[model samples]
Target: MNASRLLLGSFLFALASAASAATACAPTIDKPWVRSAPPGAKSLAGYLVLRNGCDAPVTVVDVESLDFGMPMIHRTVEEGGVSRMRPAGKLEVPPGGELRFEPGGLHLMLMRPLRPLADGDVARVRLVLADGRRVFAEFPVRRAAP
Candidate 1:
């Protein structure tokens, strides 16, 4: 009877450890940033680095910003020697990997500013993950040199 009880305890411990490991497999965000709008400019852009710690891929479905009327994922493409902005449907990050949004690449297009953002101010942005997790980030406003 004692041997059977010991085996059962060991099995329970292993199950608990497995559960903890699975819970840790979620995506994380780091160093979220945003570019300050130029004087009198109505819109701005944001960038960030996302790390996927999960064993499965994660998709970013949408973004929400309190300071802008609408937030959309956008990318800059060059066609016919002209550069233009286009909408990105969704942002994806691979398992145990990272995705970076930087200048001249995939970025958040913050449109229709509700109010003027001053230098050194901070804005709150929320990123919605496909797994229904919401990540909140505080992006600083700084002057982007021309």
Candidate 2:
């Protein structure tokens, strides 16, 4: 009886692992990272590359983070002589296409961390998709862009 129970437990664990792997097969995030900021700073920058391998477009409508009070997607634009940032509403990645979030361009505005994040710490974030699915990514906090 004990042997049978052990076999059942192993099968369940394997099934759970396969489910997680399948969810990450499409619309994957690569090299997600957060830039380290000085202590007491209100905001920090996050960068990552997103690739969509699905048949249809993947639209990221919102960013959610337990580590940050407010997390948003933003684009940096230069108008005349001034550089400004505006909210990037619903960034879409075409099928088999890649979208980049880097410095001086599209980035994650990680505003007001719930707790102080140190270098080497990982910030957990979730990209809420338009189709009601969420993709998860872990951004490592670093002094330089990764």
Poorest stretch of ten by lDDT in candidate 1: 137-146
Instruction: Kindly list the per-residue Cα lDDT of model 2 for residues 1-146, writing each as its tens digit.
Output: 99999999999999999877656556988999999999988999999999999777888999999999999999999999899999999888998999999999999999999999989999999889887788899999999975
Cα TM-score per model: 0.77, 0.82
Q: Give me the candidate number with maximum lDDT.
A: 2
lDDT of 1 by residue, 1-146 (tens): 99999999999999999978766666766777678867678789988888887898888999898988998888889999998989877788888899887789888898888888888887788888877777788888766622
lDDT of 2: 0.91
lDDT of 2 at 128: 91
Please list all clashing residue pairs in model 2, or write none if there are none. Answer: none
